[model samples]
Target chain A: MSTSEGTTSSVKVGGLTLEVHRRGAGKPLLLLAGEEQLELDAPFVAELARTHEVIIPSAPGFGHSERPDWITSPDDIAYMYLDLIDVLELRDVVVVGFALGGWIAAELATKTDRSISKLVLVDSYGVKLGSPTDRDILDIWTSRPEKVLAAKWADPAMGKRDFSKMNDDELTIIARNIESFARFCWEPYMHNPKLKQRLHRIKAPTLLIWGEKDGVISTSYGEGFAKLIPGARFAVVPGAAHYPQIEAPEAFLSTLRGFIG
Target chain B: MDAWHFTEMPYPNLPPIDSLSTMRVSLPNKLFDPKIGADLYNRYLDEYMIADDLGLNLLCNEHHQTATCIDVAAPLTAAILARQTSKGRICILGNPIANRGDPLRIAEEMAMIDCISHGRLDVGFVRGVPYEIFAANTNPTTTVERLWEGIDLVVKAWAPCDEPFNFEGRFTQRRAINLWPRPYQTPHPGIWITGSSDLENIKRAAGRGFVFATFLQPHEKVKWMFEGYRSAYRDTGLPGGGGTAYMPLVYTAETEEEAEKGAKELTWYLNAKAEPQYRNPPGYVPVDFNVNALKGTFTGRTDAMRAKTMEFLKEEGVMVYGTPDSVAKQIKRLYDLVGGFDHLLMMQQAGWLDHARTVKSMSLFAKEVYPQIRDLPRTKPLESRAAAE
Candidate 1:
């Protein structure tokens, strides 16, 4: 259970062995990950863990998590997290999610606000904000590698990985994460068709954050997403792209602190 | 030794390769001049007609949003060949059933084509290539499962069911499943399934008594696959002999000089480039395959294949091209190496090999090479052969 950052543990939830990364000790703050796994020792995570009981779990089928055959969509993951909350006995938890994780967080909130006290979605993906013909998000699967990299971070180099040098375990995790991402997002192209209509159902206090330079999904799209959730405030982190928490950690945390505190 | 003539029907005239990042998926369609494409389609169909006249079976394949194959839909071409050609058995290798919307529709279309050809139809179902995951807008993670389910549904639909049965599967649902026009062939025309590296699918295809095919891999790998299929076929104890097929670039000429030139031109099919990211879409291939790819034990086509010389290709048994007698010898060598394969899917035309050269190659292959190797004995059981050895 002990790790370099804090501790790693597995919690049996909804027939899946959920891999949870825990740091700090205070009020529960459930952190959901996005395209890439969170850097457990990142300054932003370290800072947040100082003020909150930071708990991060890899979405089912991502990282070391066991994905049962029945867990096929983000909605299923959301339901599993709901089970995680009851099993861990966490209450008044502040739920924060990034990118794909943000989509799951929003889905979880819409279903029930019983365990959630507040919600923060950072550069999230889960809603259709455009006309049927319009593309609201960049398709990383089909887009040129350079285009996808450039759109993913303010500095494209931040998104680049020397996969050839990566070890087998590292490569396996990356492959599994991508496969899981595709499982949830490929058909709907990164958004749940019904999530747009259900955003109103989220009863918790909400904040939507966008990186000002995020090319994957524009700030206007973020603003439109915020408008869907009643009382949700939209904040923009300057000098960042799709992954503001990685590219502009301090700015992202400050905005998150202002709203959550 | 039934030979099937095939081409990707490529529109090779394009701007320099350096100007484009990829040849597929996101390639701009505006660059495709419809006038030239019109001429190319007619020429390609004309090549198929020539193959038909020469007593070669015709095979058509489909790819989407790529200049490499302008034949966007194989059924359209298969339907055309079914009507236009008299004797040649028509095969579409085949409908991307997993990517397609309705399995019933595919069943209907294949059945219609079978009726038109009067049972000279070999229906092929494919999971499509990794790059096609983008073009088809289908989920890659569940494609293999979807493909198998789709095949099962199609087979059941083609079965002699008097009552309309309901089909309820994970990917597809139907209230009533009664095929209007049953296939012309009894118990349906021959079912063919193709896979490159998936041995499980090869075994499954064999177990079901479907003709299994692997295209353009190194012969050693094909030999391994053939061994796997033979073993699995034995395990299943399927009735009648199982059918196995192989596709290799094939061109034959009257002289060595022309044969070498045609062989080089035909490799244009191998050189069609897609960006590395597009080439390995997540979930399109199994995680083990991707993990192995990252470790550099790549099972898919390697970059070496693109840079391979005609000599190297011939040596690898990926391509069989030479004078008529030489071509026969190369195929016989391949036959021995892979134990044996019943159907030879010949990619006789590709790249800048002009229509004249394609026709010439087909004619030469049919007239000379075909007769020389047409009756190679049916492959004896590998175990029996090993015991004999």
Candidate 2:
């Protein structure tokens, strides 16, 4: 992944001071991150920045962002982002969310599409398509690391992290990410119970991008999710698992561009 | 010092350990034969009664979704012991209030137990184990906070109040809070807190004058926690002395061979397995603990502990067994090492250790080991001792 030059600074939203990375120029694109915070060096991030001014803010309790104790749910995160959208005063903005970020983006769109012109959810997690007893999401917290990795990426090696090779700061950030993800997703197990019912409230042109080989939450789940949203278009990038943007950036970008254009 | 006899009442008749990925969380309940469970429960209760007859205190604990501990409800077991055992304080160490739906329910149940035992009940509260987050459908990140809040609620509920008081906590809330039966012991029965790690929580427990307990931990680790407790207790100027307890596998017999055989059966408790996912739930422990684990410097439970040899366990004071004379010597050595604990919570029976063997071990421990350590002082804090010196 080629490193893209992006200025980093903290944006004060309500009580939260979030770390934001801004790159490129053109249309404003607010990128919501997933379990792990995405850096500017990510290939898909660079691709998005090429045609659009990408505004990526690390959600509260994630990366170096300041998280208030009261902000314990994904909806709390969505509300904070809503304030940021108004704070930045970015109108007709295109919002793209990945995984947990996708869930947040969908949540944001449901509440209001005031500034959001279009919404893109890449392997999003925010609706229950199965029965009460049916497990909608693979439990990453309790599963073995190897098992989770195998289910997370098309090639398991891509998702493998060697903590031994990382520095204290790096390791601490990883811990923070895991802790924050658990804080929000643990009780509901990564979906808002009311989100499925509220999908029609979104006014933004929506796209659901899925990885064909995504084992974390399968493409079939993505398809089921798309049917719930009003006129939400679903597309799959071939030969990619949960993280299509990282695994097959070209195909992912093509699918994303083809929709937003 | 007081000796408390205890057991996990583990059912160890399963297939070979190698065949199963885990012994907890996702283990099928169909594998558990209720016939054997009934026998184990009745036999375990009989052993506790035997301990009572032998003049030893009793301790029982609860764990969910695991074959290692069949006692899923500590209060129920404690309640039974309260009625059956005429002597010996029945200590349920303890209720997993953090995972429980209502802390008030625990307060009510414990109060009833205390009434049944007529003030001989020692109530213990615990932040449920890591794997319990899955079983209880609880968020791990919030449990420690929830535990403290739950304790506060339970404590407040037990206090004498003319009218019902409202409890509004972060994790739990109620319109009216008043406990029925209030507790036979004035205010409440003795409160005990147990966790092997979390030095901060240990200090807090001491500050609140709650008896702190650690089970099956290395003596060095226990010593660290005890030191923390002592310091906190001194700072608070608490009157009850540094109330602390240490539990280790304890088995004694006429011959070394018999004792060794009994000790081997106890090791089955240590061999209890859970998959990697259930071992450390995110936010269940301090971030530093996880960071240290990643850095390979974590001092918590390790794989080596499961496969611990007899000599290794004895050397570390994780287990104390053999003839009465030898067991007494080992206990004395451990006593000096960890300053001094008021209670010696002894796991005298576990795994497939039969009723006859359990009774024999309890009898030997009470007759031989308890008498030797009974007069030993619950050592004063180091500062107080130094001042006296």
Candidate 3:
């Protein structure tokens, strides 16, 4: 429904096969896959795949890549791709970022409108949930017992993940990333104070998505993002959590599809 | 603009021309890529004014829920077309209101567009599709009765009455209130009747001087649609005689190869498309009822309609497709077949056709074919037609 200028794409971007599925014929939409490990089931990313040439990079440390300790903040992860896009020579690219990846997209989008075209940030928690009373303890992903997990997720089934079974070293790395993420963002928590003012500088169109039922970040944060960015839209998806990319995938992706100019 | 046919009903005499717009709405599922629907409406005042400027006629039809045909259920889309295409002849063959609670809305919308378009309006009323009737939870059994009642109410609303529109039909209740913003045309833009009806409907249309048209099907099925009007015209002795109209799905191209290429898959698409409609009489979704029997009835003797159209490279091609020349030859047959062609509005947007495709068809037709038929002498103003006749 949204056309990325040239009306027709002369050369189709992206390869025919990727572990994840992508569909339709138009601009290349880059997906960070997840805040967690990206294994192709990032629903919103998959939904975007329906009409776009979706690019999902399995963030090095999380899925197949060896877990590294020094790379704490998301800015470290978004750093390489400024040149990768040049190597691939992709143009008019739209980035759909969620959770941790949302943090990277936010950080990356503020710096470059060069290779990047548009940015879509979902129910993300790059900041410390931004509200004290609205404190989402789930942002750090510590080993909270069932009752506290249920309280945080609101969905009772989400109360049960085998966090206790993880090795201490793996747990340590996870905790470090959390601490580094909060450091880059906790002052504003979910947003960069400089980024909010700088949003007007980014030439590309920006679209933000949040869950109406988001147990992680208040929908007000989504509104905050919309107001901060020039020509930005924040749509709240129903029955979702901090992870709208997973919960209400269709609605989340559709809002993304409609927003990317 | 004055020479442009203001109403699209069954007209017989038209010069040979290739490529014309024909209106056909694909069911909406294949119509979209998602569970949620897509909106096909573009501009209102702009489209009509553009068509008026470019010499193209405007059209829209009825539909209910199905991902394919959004909200023809309310006729808002058609009204939008009316407002948008104000410069062109506004055609709304709608409001399957026989199944509706009250048809006053139909009268109101028609009158509004008529006035807005300055009487550049053609009003088409129909006996609701039987499946659509059942889908609306109305009585398909009394389709004709409901249709007759609808016409009576709309006419009374338009023509005015010494007494109020005081009448009680099986599905209505109306005692008074003539509509406002009365249409600009004195007698109201040409009245049209569309659907599969016997002589009675045709005779009535002839007596009232209403224009007659049908959808999808070919001539044989409703040849009586023509004969009945002619019969009534001869019997009642209207000076110029009655005329007929058809709004089949039409498409044309730069050359026969292009047309053949385009229409080759179109008929296959039509048959494939017609199945679901025929199979589902009134399913969980309204348009999904896919009423095949009635769908067939709307078309011609299916096989004959198919083959007969092919022979008439003269106007009988199975479908409207070909380079400018082949199309002109085929359209000529249709002009002659119905005896006169006062109007021909196309239905181009089909399932899976993007806006780019729609623009291409309109562009080609506007460039090549429309020129051939720009001087439609059979389509003179009423006073001129009367003098010629």
Candidate topping DockQ: 2
lDDT of 1 by residue, A1-261 (tens): 112587888999976799999999999999998867754545788888888999999889988898776787898899999999999999999999999999999999999878999999999999998998998998788777788889988999888777887777879888888788888888788888899999998899999999999999999999999999999999999999998888899888889999887
Query: For candidate 3, lDDT tens digit of each residue in B221-322?
Result: 445466556666656656332356665445566666655545543343242222222222221112211122223322323333444444352243235666
Q: What are the interface RMSDs of all the models? A: 1.8, 1.1, 29.2
Assess candidate 3 and give its TM-score to the true structure: 0.47
- Candidate closest to the true structure, highest lDDT: 1
Candidate 3 C-alpha error for residue B55, in Å: 1.1
Q: Tell me, what's the RMSD of every candidate?
A: 2.2, 2.0, 24.2
TM for every model, in the order presented, reads 0.96, 0.97, 0.47
Model 3 bad stretches (over 4 Å): A1-261, B1-39, B43-50, B71-74, B161-165, B219-224, B239-242, B272-318, B374-389
lDDT of candidate 1 at residue B32, scale 0 to 100 = 92
User: By DockQ thresholds, what CAPRI class is model 3?
Assistant: incorrect
lDDT score, candidate 1, position B311: 84
lDDT tens digits by residue: candidate 2, B1-389 = 99999998787878888898888898888889999889888988888888899999999999889988889999999999999989899998888888996999999999999999999999898898888889898888888888899998888899999999887778887987777879999868899998777888988998888999998778888888888888878877784434989988999999999899999998887878888888888877877777887787874474658767888999898999999999999999999988888999998887788888889889988898889999989856558634322
